[model samples]
Structure formats: structure tokens, C-alpha cells
Target: MTPAPIDIPDEIRAQVYVHALAAFPAECCGYLVGARAGVVDAVVACTNAQDQGAHPTHPERGADTGFVIAGAELLAFARAFDGDRPPRVVYHSHTNGRAYFSSVDQDLASGPAYPVQHLVVGVADGRVTEAALFAWSDNAYVEVARWQGPREGGSTA
Candidate 1:
């Protein structure tokens, strides 16, 4: 069965997309945990710095950097929620390209670690091309739905 579409307010979507883009050259990853009804309850920005050997280390090519969400940070985020809204989705941005879940992303999310949705935002050439949403099920990342929020930086062009 197909999943319901995910929706984000224009303003919030723009902000999230911009944040992902701003962290260019390095993977920008974060969490958006909130209650449903097509609105965001809280958007928590997680650190992408790999320090605990969780993320793949690549030669700093000054272009792409591996994204890592530390264990402590994840735990802290969960504790912070305390069953309030609960983690609804994990979000990340792809700099220098479009928003599509790579194999690495799938591998990382494929487990009981997180039983929620994943949002990938792709930014390219000053244009936010696409945003894809996935859910971890049956030992794989299944494409649930796609979303479009709003434009940022006030470009009428």
C-alpha cells in the first residue's frame, strides 16, 4: 500500500532546505520529530561531525564530507522527547547534487535503530530540485512519498 503524502509549511520547508544547503561541502544531517497533521512540532538539528567511528571517513576532498549522527546526540534527542512527540522522521541534505537516498543512507537506516521515515533534500545550482521521503520496512528503505515546501532567499527569478 502507498503511504500518505507528507506535507510541510512553505516557510518551514524553505528553512529546512536552506539549512541543508548552507552546510554544503559537508553532509548536513538533522531530525524532525513531531506530531502528525502535516505540521512540524520540533525540528532538531543534529551534528554531522564524525567522531565515534560511526561514519565512513573519506579523504577530505574539499567537496563531499561524510555525514554522521553521533550515538550520544541521538540518545539525547530521544531523551529530550521523552515520548512527547517522538521521532517521526530523520532528515538530511545533499549538497552538490539532488535529494535522493544513496545506498549509504539506506544501509545506515536499515535496522531497528530507527523505525520512522527519512527525508532527503537535494540542492543543486542554487535550486532545490527534489525532496524524497522513505520509510524503513521489511529490511529496506521504501519510497513512501515526496514533498515540496517553499522557495527561499526571495528569488522571484
Candidate 2:
């Protein structure tokens, strides 16, 4: 059976958008940490680390176009929570296209290794355009929720 979808608070949602917008030319990378039942109370904006070679899977995408949580930084983030509040979601933005889980996202997520909701914020031409939340279940990545922002030259999907 499928698990129930997570309900992200409006404040958290707005923060994600703001982070995405701030990242702009590069992808924004971060985590949502909280104590409640999947309602994120805080947003932690982590280093992109893409230029830092955090991910070897897709070097072509580099820092300006890609994102990585990084090794030491991931551990740091884990320690940052330290049983007080667990990581509820791993969030990043697609700076060049629409929000969807790319192959790189899958490799980074690693089939339940980084088990949590994965949120992708889409930014194109320097505008916050869309968002989607993906969850892993039954050994596959599936979208659990979605949100679209006002798009340039198009309608919100």
C-alpha cells in the first residue's frame, strides 16, 4: 500500500521558493528539518557543492547547472539534526528546466539510501517556475505531490 502524502506548510513552501529564487544561476540545495509528522518547521540551505565535485555521476552538469549535498556536509547536516529533529525532505532546484527527478537526482538519492521526500524546485530564465515532491517506495521513485509557480511565457501547470 502507498503511504499517505506529506503536507508541507505554506510557510515552508514559500521558503523553498525563496531559496530557489536566491540560488538563481545555480541550483539551490538544502534540507527541511522538523519534529512534527512531516510538517517541516525549518529550512536549511546547504552548499550546492556541485562545483566542489560532490557528485561524480554527472560532471558535465557542474555547479552552475547542478547540485550536490556533498559527503562531509551531508554528515554535518545529519549531525545538525542529531535526534532533535530528523530531516523531513531533501530539496534542490532545477535551474534550467521544469521540476522532475532527473537521473542524477536518482543516483544522488540512491534507492532509499537517502530515504526521505525529495523536492525539486524548477527555475527557468531566473524565475521560480514549479516544484514537485518525489518519494521512494516499492523500489522506485514516484511523485507524491506537486506545486507550480507563475511561469514566464506560459501558464502555471
User: Please, what is the whole-model Cα lDDT of each candidate in the order they appear?
Assistant: 0.65, 0.75
Off by over 4 Å in 1: 36-38, 51-66, 147-157
Please provide TM-scores, in order, for all candidate models, with all chains considered together: 0.73, 0.81
In the range 22-136, model 2's lDDT, one tens digit per residue, is 8666678998888847577889888887755434565335433446777887887767655767787888888665888887777667667654788888877767777899888
Query: Among these predicted structures, which one has the highest TM-score?
Result: 2
Clashes in each model (backbone N, CA, C under 3 Å)?
Answer: 2, 0
Clashing residue pairs in candidate 1 (N, C-alpha, C atoms within 3 angstroms)? 98-122, 99-122
Candidate 1, residues 1-157, lDDT tens digits: the string is 5555455555666677777767654556787766744566567778776523433354233223346777888777667556766667778877555666677777677784665677888766655667888876667777777765345676654
Alpha-carbon RMSD, each predicted model: 4.1, 4.0
